[model samples]
Target chain A: MNINILYAALAPIVAILLGLLYIGIGRKIIARLQRRYGPPFYQQYIDTIKLLAKKTVSSHGVFFSLGPIMGLAGSMVTLLFIPFGSAAPLLSFHGDIILVMYLVVIAPLGMALGVGEGSNPNGSIGMARGLTLMLAYEVPFVLALFSVVLYTHTTSIAQIVQSQAGEWSLLKFHGFNWLTFALPISAIVADICLQGMLGEKPFDQVIAPHEIASGPMVEYGGKYLGMMVINHALHIYIETALFVDIFLGGGPVWFFIPATFSVFILSLIINGVLPRFRIGQALKFYWGVPLILAVIGIIYTMVVIK
Target chain B: MKQKTEQKKSLNQGGKNMTEEKSIDFFEYFIGPQHPGITGNFGVILNAVGDEIIKAQANPGYLHRAFEKLMEQRMYLQNVPLVCRICVPEPDVNEALYSMAIETLTGIEVPERAKYIRTIVLEMARLAAYLFYFGGTAATLGLYTLPNWSFGDRDYILDLFEELTGARIYHIYMQPGGVRRDLPKDFTKKLYSLLQTLKKRIKEYDGIFFDAALFKKRTKGVGVINKDMAIEYSVTGPNLRASGIAYDIRKDTPYLAYPDINFNVITENEGDFYSRVMVRRREFEEDIKILEQLIDKLPSGEVWNRYPMPLNWKVEKGDVYVKVESTKGEYGYYVVSDGSEKPRRIHVRGPSMTHGIMLLEKLLKGQRIADISPIMFSLDICPPDIDR
Candidate 1:
């Protein structure tokens, strides 16, 4: 068997496993914050198994069922470009970061299509909200990433990680020399954008439980919900992993996962306490404050950090 | 978009000017018998064009159990339990109203201490209902934490009710004359500590919910029931008070132990959603004050009146109307006796029947879908009250 083929096969399973761990840990942390006994750290795995084992699995047709599959595939494909530790990714290229960014959108677009055709108005409304939020948050996020690509003078995520090797990034565990230390404003804006990306509270109007009945997941049940849950876990892993790779710098296998989990924990704690932001307010904040921060960071990178 | 607008314009021209074929889209939004924003098994049908609500019809029959007709069938003494069911969140007000009406018809004098006890129970119910109101209103705006905290704190109040009346939601403690039982010997001390806990909790609520920037943006200027409209629609409770009206049955009519008790009749000038909820929030403080005064001036005597409400007790045929200041609003009860064991007629004037249907429908027009739940909850439109 080819070495690349072996990695390609193992990557998705590893991503799924990591996704489940992150979700389970995230829920436990949020539960502890709420001062209540939460589910066990392995609860997401059990829930996933239970959902897959559900007796009454319903679907609105083939395309509706295709949504989660597309999402899972997208998550897997996006992970191919992102390196974990010193090990080479399943697929890496000169400008894999741009490809990964575009690939990230395909999953949500796929889910939106499924949710639209499912004929649940709540889901459609949620899809609409999600897409609109996507437009708003993407501007600052792309700007922030574009600035990094320009400053690093490379489009490859692996090269970007390697550029920040040694004491160049803060996560190097030696001095305050990192992308965040130079352009903290961009990192801040990226964190806010990450909230929108994760579909968590304050920015969670897309899945507003009271407003639209969990939004796009309203019609999703049984196996589809299980798939959705898996997609959600993969989403958390991919996003936090992306954050870790881009800002915190990819590291040796020993230190990278913990660093990624720490960033996710910070986001989770913030999500647990804050009330959801109305879509309009969320849009305004993204376009207003974070946009400014991204612009400032881009300028600083161009003039100073370079 | 142009064609649709032109189509709308042509339709406005009595369909005579229709020259082009076009399709117009409208949404018929049915907001829950199962929705979280709904206080109970309640639903609203909103006729909307785009996100704007064109017509909102309040549906009230989902929770109907026919409490008035049920009350008419049962004897006056036996009707206590039935009246409490009329409003689920706070039942003591109904119990008090029923008792007061019977007291008036029979000319029974409640002991001073019994009056004080009834007042304490009413205040406790008010506090519980307000806490529920806070939870519902905040939850409508996507503040999930407040509901948990407020409801958790309200359990202490419910615990007090359970200790006093042996029930929580439907505390049928007040009888035709006074109360069903005496204090639990440590109720005042327990109540004082509970009040202190609640007082501390209110600051937390203010920080997280009431004073929240997002909450203010969501609620402010959303549902404004103007002074004249409030009066015309017969809106009562915190809703009416929030609309700049100072009318309260407890203060104006001076019922139960209210005439002797000291507390402010909380009011706000803005007839909007925020004002209405804030009025209830302030009233929660006033209820604590009233409870504190009731404890200080609690005379040691009979909790229940000496008058025996026999199973076969009969009175000279008469009708009486009695109203009380409940947490929701003025909860009024009317009774007519035909010199029989069972009352000939019983009618309830629930506050929600006015605020829920008439005012809710009227306010919802031209508002966004996001504003619907906030407006409904800020009105504190309990569906059971409307259904009953």
Candidate 2:
């Protein structure tokens, strides 16, 4: 019980640090692509520490002060619920997939509540865009999730990972029994949804600096902004790790780290080249292409299950 | 308490019935003078509902240095440095236009070689400005790679300028009678190589930025100025050409060595933000061809014609409006001289005076808030030009 308690304590710290490292490395990759000598891979760690160390922090009210805390708390809770690999399902329960989904939303909602109290139109608009974007991407994402759950006959994330473990005889795919190969269409749809969830262009409208001035975090500064940065790092880990667990066969740590980092780097490469879509355009895209693909994937899953 | 009751009564009476009335809450915010997204030290007061802009007012004067009024207090030569500061990105246009105005009023005919040299300087400035436009427009749309590439490429042009004029940004090279100095040794060879490098790099820009589907989808038809509207607003340069109007000051009024050089006035019919940007993109190539031709035909003679003694020079009483085709638009200088060392009055007609204020305000109405920066950049509205 003490070892389990210690593992629970260690999981979030490891996740946050690894997430920051991925972001810093992603920045370096984008810089190299653009012919620039980017900052060191630990630049995010330095930035977070510097921001947290700053003394002055302005607040609009109780909600303003509570916003970053709530966001950090929400991301922490979401991270705890999602299993990172085979060895570490920190706080995962039998029906935690549904709980994880609900928890994933709390961070942005908390952010909205806090930014609303700040009385900034940019922040409000950012929150609105973010929520609207959430609504758009969630449709396809939920459909993909449903397909994965139905194919494996489980709502428990651990069972889902166990289901993807053994090899299939009909397809005779050898090395890894990841669902990405078994349910290819659903996996593709989920990856597209992941692009939106990650907030990389051509879908990065929420914090479009040129459009609305960094959106929800426009007025946040000092420690509040620092917390948001930490929350963002954790948020990245949670979203990508969830994808890995569902599609990539939540293997040991060796497999999990590379799989997650590759997924993130793919998004970063796309982000470096593409311009942002307008909010309306983003909605239209999510509803049109990925939505139809998601519907087809669910139908395929249903047919295969029968 | 009475005022509150009166306000409530007025609100109720303004509509026929409360159930039939709808109130829109406009979110008003200022987008710079301190914001990063803005092009320069400029501001746009945006009144928006949701993500759509209901109204946008161009808030100029943040970078106002009263350049026109200051020119009145200085001599013709003294104002050359001051005028260049009016437009930061492409300062050579100001120097050329100011010198052209003074030369015309004083009737100081520049030498044959000087005209060629001036033409070379002007085209180089235009090329540099277009490079800046590519980086800035791409950055506003969030394709950060193009900015890194194009801005790095622009430094090559600035290096050439520095070698010639002893300054990188504000090169006060164009003097009243002619250029301040002749071309340095092997300058043409270096320019030819730079053009070769740019020709190769432009394809990379096309691969990443200009031909990218997302860039096209974002910019096409976003900030359109139809030909009729373009003419009504007196839009000039690449913007005017983009609207299918083939009006080019370089072609219509042959200045410097343009009459001898062979180049087409690049135009696009769509008149949208994409067309505006494409016009400049094609014009970059056209400018390269013009510079190559100028170097091939550069004559060997004096670059500067001797004027009257400095610090006591006087001009003949006259007024003249000399205009040049800058990268943005028709940059004109109206100089009225009462035959004095300092002119009686001078008026600078920067292209941003029309494009940045009236055209920008008109284009921004009903546009999504996301498009504000991209449209401003597409029009190439340098704020200092407007403020000055």
True contacts kept of each: 0.30, 0.68
TM-score of 1: 0.93
User: How does candidate 2 fare on TM-score?
Assistant: 0.94
Per residue, candidate 1 scores C-alpha lDDT tens digits across B126-209 of 899899999888877876778878888889899988998898788878887788888997999999999998999899899888
Candidate 1, position B260, lDDT: 88
Measure candidate 2: CA RMSD. 5.3
Instruction: List the DockQ of the predictions in order.
Output: 0.34, 0.50
Q: Could you give candidate 2's per-residue lDDT for residues A115-150 as a string of tens digits?
A: 888777778778889999999999999999999988
Best by TM-score: 2
Model 1 residue B355 lDDT score: 81
Model 1 lDDT per residue over A1-306, tens place: 898888888877777888899989888877665445689999999999998888645677888888877877787788787788545677888888889889999889989988876766667777888888999899999999988887888988888777666632444464243567656777888988998899877788888877777878877888888888888887888888888777887466666888778888888777776777667777888999899889988898888743
What would the per-residue lDDT of candidate 2 be over residues B227-282, giving only the tens digit for each residue?
Answer: 89998999999999999999899999989899999999899999999999999999
User: What pairs collide in candidate 1?
Assistant: A169-A178, A170-A178, B237-B329
Judged by lDDT against the true structure, how good is candidate 2?
A: 0.87
- Window of ten residues with lowest summed lDDT in model 2 chain B: B12-21
